[model samples]
Target: MLKQYSFEKTAVQSFDAQTTLALKTEDLQVFYGANHAMHDANLGFPKNQITALIGASGSGKSTYLRSLNRMNDGIATVTGKIWYHGVNINEPNVNIYEIRKHIGMVFQRPNPFSKSIRENIVYALKANGMKSKADLDERVETSLRGAALWDEVKDTLDKSALSLSGGQQQRLCIARSIAMAPDVLLLDEPCSALDPISTVKVEETLLELQKQYTIIIVTHNMQQAARVSSQCAFFHLGHVMEYTSTGTMFSNPQIPVTQDYIAGSFG
Candidate 1:
């Protein structure tokens, strides 16, 4: 069992409400067995905005991202307090499946199933018991277009997903995630394995998606963070060194550690 604290008690004394803001963490802490992966992390993510979590390896960047969608619980031992929709996600009564429905995730590597591209997207809807053929068709097409890969594959929806290039496969994964209509999309270093052109395509897709979903991305690329995020968070040793508008963070970081990290003193 891990001890936890309320957001108001440990993090922000006052949290201003936002129509677009979809998720918030107040003094969130996470431990894998005895290892504390995250420490005193606090953040507020506005809806329709992009937040980039940037840090060196083993800095708890991905750990913090996983907590939002309750993906960390599969590990043998995990504990943390996360809040979405004004309720504590770590609470016993909270439904994990329901939480994940609204909070989608895209992993670092594209893991498309050994199925057709159209089937991959439709399977999600079908599994969720969505039976409307018209709606399913609309969702599948919309999500693919949203990921910027529809035109290329629209003619061959039945084609095997495995046939796609690395970049296209990643986009298909994104399309599958979006077909679920999640309010918050969590991306963990999604472009690390992609080529330069593919990386730009992924970033561009995210930029376009920000109009309807709150986006949180964990990336080691400082330039990528600076290029795509509206807000940037720098993490060091499980601690959030600073969180602020991207412009302010890169130009004039409030904390010395954040400034040092930005200057490439140490990852």
Candidate 2:
């Protein structure tokens, strides 16, 4: 039988005014039809840092992550404030397209286009009216370098993105997202499909990327959370049971639910 955990005991960290946040959620709740998928999720993501959402399957980590940049639109009802740059982006009148430009997302699996590597990087930019060859070329290089894929593919820009290895393709997807110069990047299990070596590459890329973009990642791997994130949030059955430093979360979880989940005794 599945163990039941109390929602009463919780620990979510709050940043002070001195610490700048790239995004903040207040009383964020998500519902799919009658099913409450996520409860009141309030958390702050510090600028240029990485935050990992760790939880078991169906715990609503992905649901909450999707709602951050309005990826849940038409799929689920997400209510409450998603504050970005002092604006409540959760408002119905807010421009989701603009919001997404600032807050980008990469999926669980690598989904690269059938086009060439260069084309994949420039597709959105061209659609947005960047017609200059020189500018497009520069963006392609800058973004690929940002994702740490430039050296490997610099000479093969015209090659098909799908022709690259799984890890390369995923990094390309990340490069595509960063090409927009988003202030925040959201990744859902970015390394799950990767092999150990590939996973390390992606993790290294994330560590470097945190110097410029605030990153929020949802991963089932606790070790990945400990390796990459400064702050960790533990989700259980739609509730954020604990939020604290990664070291503390792994070594000293405050709540029973969090401790059990981290110890692999539950979840």
Candidate 3:
């Protein structure tokens, strides 16, 4: 039988005024029909840092992440204050498209377009009215380089993106998101579908990316969380059970639920 832990004892960390937060959520809740998938999830993401959201499946980590950029709209009722640059982006009148432009997302599986590698990166830019050949060329190179995929795919820019391996496809997806010049990059299990070598490459890319973009990753792998994230948040049964430094969360969790989850006794 699975043990039922109390939800009253949660440890969520908050940043000081001196620390600049790239994104924050206050009183964040999510509901789908009659189901409450997330509770009041208050958390802050420091600028130019990687924060990993780790939990077992169905623990609401992805739900809370989707709400950060209003991805839960029309899918779930999210009532909360999602503050990005002093703006409550959760407001009804906020432009979700614009919000997504600044806060990009990369899904679990790599979903690159059927177009060529160069076209894959330039498609969204062209749709957004960027027509300068020189600028478009620069963005394509820059984003690809940023994602650590330029060297591998630069020679084959005209080839179909589908021809790349699983790892390459995922990196191309990351390049696609960075092509938008977003401030925050949200990744939902970006490495869950790759080989060990590919996973290492993705992890290395993310570590480098934190110098330019704030990253929030939802991963079920504890080792990956410990390797890439400066901070870690653990979710359980629709609640954010703990948030702290990656070292502390894994070594000395403040709550029992977090301790058990980390110890592999339960999740």
lDDT of each: 0.85, 0.95, 0.95
TM-score per prediction, in order, is: 0.91, 0.98, 0.99
Q: How many clashing pairs does model 2 include?
A: 0
Compose the digit string of candidate 3's lDDT tens values, residues 80-172. Answer: 899999999999999999999999999899999999999999999998899999999999999999999999988999999999999999999
lDDT of 1 by residue, 77-111 (tens): 34555768778887667898888889999999999
| Descending-lDDT candidate ranking | 3, 2, 1
Better candidate by TM-score, 1 or 3: 3
Cα shift from native, residue 199, model 3 (Å): 0.4
Task: List the pairs of residues colliding in candidate 3.
Answer: none
When summed lDDT is taken over every stretch of 10 residues in candidate 3, the lowest stretch is 1-10
Measured over all alpha carbons after superposition, the RMSD of each candidate to the real structure, in angstroms, is 4.9, 0.8, 0.7
Lowest summed lDDT window (length 10), candidate 2: 1-10
Task: Report how far residue 261 has shifted in candidate 3, in Å.
Answer: 0.8
Q: lDDT of candidate 3? A: 0.95
In model 3, which runs have C-alpha deviations exceeding 4 angstroms? none
Q: For residues 1-267, could you state the per-residue lDDT of candidate 2 as single tens digits?
A: 668888997998899889999999999999999999999999999999999999999999999999999999999999999999999999999999888988999999999999999999999889778999999999999999999999999999999999999999999999999999999999999999999899999999999999999999999999999999999999999999899888899999999899888889866
